[model samples]
Target: MLELHLNFCNLVEIPDAIGNLHFLEILNLMGNNFSTLPSLKELSKLQLLNLKDCRQLKYLPNLPSRTDLSSKRSLPESFSSKKDPWAFERFYDYMEAGLNTFGCPELIELERCTSTALSWTLQILLQVHYQYILPSLWNIPFPSIISSIIGGSEIPSWFNNHREGMGSIITIDESPLMHKGNNCIALACCVVFGPPASRRKAPPIIHSLNHVSVPFLCAEDRITEDHLWWFYVTSGSHIWSTKYENLKLQFHIIRESDIESWSFHGKKYGYRWVYEKDLEESNLTMICSR
Candidate 1:
């Protein structure tokens, strides 16, 4: 078969026979219970593989490389090189056929960098869950979604709707249809970790809109360092969908006193608001980044 759609099927595993379908190109396995995937090294034509909402999935298998390592086809006399059989020129030649306006080199490189960053961030979250005892925070179900991380203690002042309390109401003038163009329908927050309290678990951060409560895992660590823990949720994910205009959104932290400073994680935008505490980590941040 050329296409397979098995989303929301409560699937625990996929058989290896899937790779045998050399002509298969699309595979959809979202909203399932699988934890891993089989190798698709033989599916040369495969593309558009979707695994969204596979919450239990923990890892992926080896993917086929861009070239066939075992192929014995003879090379042209002019192209033969004595150095490395698989040289940069060989790879470039292989890519020449598919290089187009939309799939240009720069766009491809950007996609690659984004993919790498997403993968690294997911790995960090997975390890955090298995190894730490910090208050459990829920993570986005899929790894392919665009996300980011930064360290800070205060909410950026740009969010004119924010307030000092654990929960506040904010309104937007746009409708749900207008938000379709945006990748994320939800927002995330960075909970500031204050002085450690022994044997006390911090409360989960909750976002309520239209009577739906979005519970996020509390961030662990002392605010002494410069780093903000981020968590995101999509609209209508665990809650009923609500329109964006005149939105009644509320932020709730069960133990507001424990949270020294907090801020919303702006999707696709960097923060211009700097808190006074950020200066202390200036040296360490520069050293690590360099």
Candidate 2:
């Protein structure tokens, strides 16, 4: 096979058989339970390695030279030390070009806020992938649940319901037909920030979760003329079990800054999902079953 996607499978370990696939080009192990990977030395053609939320993952085997790796957190020192130092430089250039095409000025501000530009850029870009881009790109073959939030006084037309405050509880009841089979994959949300200037006093922040948190696939973007800080959960994450009668989604935001270490502003906005059963799919295929 040329590709293997075993994301969100609750897997504990990968079999050595994977390395036997010499022709495999892409391997996605996002949101799994594994702590280490089987050696991939035999797969010379492997190119993309996605380890988005392998929380316990502490090690990675040697990979092909052309392979590109993506993760929300750091990999082991053995792997990170081997990274091409210029990779993030090239990535920043690419992102700058894309943003410029759309008149995005945030790139300039983002660049000015970091001493370790590579880490900061990757952190932000990863949000773009999970919250906005991934859902659009994975629509055909994989139906996913992607959602987002931004700083706005009004809710967008896309959401089924909205509340006046920071957090809300949303629950979805299952159908009888789903007993035979189901495609319930993920949950996502979009959060809006109040104002950028109000956040200027805070320090550079790393994102995290609190209060019945689930895994997240996140992204953010600036909409010109909107003046709202929007964050979206675009693709695969927010896993809930099939046995539960209702799916409860809860979210919140926090802020912090380290003045002695980093001079940066941090802002967080809380958001919650309103489960809509019969979701329209011109943009995303929300298939209820596999």
RMSD of 1: 21.0
Kindly report which residue stretches of model 2 are placed more than 4 angstroms away from their true locations once superposed.
1-153, 167-183, 196-290
Considering every candidate listed, which one attains the maximal lDDT?
1
**Residue by residue across 14-48, what tens digits does model 1's lDDT show?**
99888887766446675677767798767654433
TM for every model, in the order presented, reads 0.28, 0.28
Please estimate how well model 1 matches the true structure, expressed as its whole-model Cα lDDT. 0.36
**Stretches > 4 Å off in candidate 1:** 67-266, 269-290
lDDT of 2 by residue, 170-281 (tens): 3334322233224322233333333233322223332322122111212212222221222233223333323455444443222111111211112223333322232323
Backbone clash tally (model 2): 21
Q: RMSD to the native, candidate 2?
A: 17.0
Candidate 1 clashes: the total is 4
